[model samples]
Target: MDKLLSNIKIEVPPGIYLKDPESSSLGKKIVENSIILLENIGFEDFNFKKLGQLIGSNESSIYRYFESKHKLLIYLTSWYWSWIEYQLVLETYSINDTKDKLIKAIEIVSRTTKQDSKYSHINEVLLNQIVINENSKSYLTKDVDIENKDGSFMPYKRVVQRISEIISAYNTSYKYPLTLASSVIESALHQQFVKIHFKSITNCNDEITPTEFFIDLTLKTLTDGK
Candidate 1:
């Protein structure tokens, strides 16, 4: 899988950036340090100037890649989902049974992220943390409608659609596959957030994981009427 992924490029919408960050060393440095800095300071406190200082580049150089911090966040989130989508496809493609495929897909998306050595510059674990803690800010904007039209969120939507198709295949009679698919993905992130900050409100803890919860819920919901 690592070998195959080494040859693959995680595509983010070109519209989100003024330049491709993966094309050059400085660009990669910008992305690499931006992730570390964003995880350290968060989006609200994160800015191009701070990232410039961390990367030893001018603030204008950062803008040469991303137009704004919001766009950078979108780029990071998009890359994260694209990475997950690749794993979802590669891991679940060989399963013959529909239910088994759906379950595997759920696990791939809902499971906690670990670092992948393939992309040495970008840290998948920190990127996952950003996705869990700061993902909504990427699209929850007045410009979201315009951005959606521009395909800025395509990677995320593709993951949901892929899982939704598997759900429909597992249970043809299921009336809300899309809703359920999106819920599973979104709820997994939310559950992780609550587990860390509001433990009293969530069932997920050391003993139980969000992956286990979603898989159980999905199987029950899809099988209940059948």
Candidate 2:
């Protein structure tokens, strides 16, 4: 353990404080700091000068690491999706019961969204843009494939597909409707977060946790087909 720790060096940005100096993890550290700044200030207000100052690094050095702010945003967005995919796969899909599978998938997704603040914020922004962009592109292009190439496979759709697959796995013999399951799953996933954070959906005064509501509502509706 001591040898491994000794070998593991982390790069300290030019002016950043480091209790223990290491260089190996410097890139990752910068990315993490970048995410914090992005979340607090957002992409519109974020500036490389400010970020470099905060990290104790020169603007030029930061640029060397990340070509541009837009590039960083894209990388961060992709990273969030990769983490989400890992989490989705970890949920046990073959639980031998259709309802349980649906509940588990919902639980994982809600837990992931609630726990990861940066990811949750990114997901909200990207999902809204993705929906609008894809819809607009589809109208513009006569070809569905061309429309997809413009803006397709948003995270929302990925989550819905994973949830649908889990539900379908358990009901393989019965062959539940994929479209119906997808609709309920998407609604259940988005409604919980959207209602509380985006806007109060109608007159519901309850501040329910996303995971509990999603798991309960999704499982019940998907299994019973009601």
Candidate 3:
């Protein structure tokens, strides 16, 4: 699986960046350091100048890749989702049982992320943190409709659609597979956020995980507690 993944390139929408960050060493450095800096200083305080200082490059050089921090966030989130979609397809594609495939798919999207050696330039763990905390900012904008039309959110939508197909295969009569699939993905992020920031409000912790909760929720909802 690692060998197969190493050969895969996670592509984001070309419209999101002024230049493709995966095309050059300097571009890759911009992406690698930007993840670390964004997680450290957060989206609100993160700027190209700070990233430039961290990478020992000029601010204008950073701008050559991303036009603005908002677009950069979209790129990061898009890349992360594309990576997750790859994991989903690779891990679940061979499972012959419909229910088993759905369970595996849920676990892949809901489980806490760990760094994969295939993409050393990306820290999946930190990228997961940014997704959990700042994912909404990428789309909750007046321009989201415009961006969606331009395929800015295709990676994320594709993930939901894949899982939704699994749900339908598991239960042909299920009327809201897409809704359930999207809810599980979005809620997984929210559950992780509350688990870390508002622990008193969520049951997920060291013993119980968001993965377990979503697995239970999805199965029960689909099967009506069968």
Best by lDDT: 3
RMSD of 1: 0.9
How well is each residue in 20-110 modelled by candidate 1, as lDDT tens digits? 9999999999999999999998899999999988988899988999999999999999999999999998899899999889889999988
The pairs that clash in candidate 1 are: none
* Count of clashing residue pairs in every prediction: 0, 9, 0
Q: Model 3 compared with the native: what TM-score?
A: 0.98
Q: Which is superior by TM-score, 2 or 3? A: 3
Model 2 Cα lDDT, one tens digit per residue, 189-226:
46554555667462222556656765665556555643
Task: Give the poorly placed runs of model 3, Cα more than 4 Å off.
Answer: none
Q: Residues 1-226, candidate 3: write the lDDT tens digits.
A: 5676689899898999999999999999999998999999899999998899999999999889899999999999999999999899899979999999999999999998988988889999999999999999999999999999999999999999999999999999999999999999999999999999999999999999999999999999999823
TM-score of each: 0.98, 0.57, 0.98
* C-alpha lDDT values of all predictions: 0.93, 0.51, 0.94
Q: Cα deviation of 146 in candidate 1 (Å)?
A: 0.5
Candidate 3 lowest-lDDT run of ten? 1-10
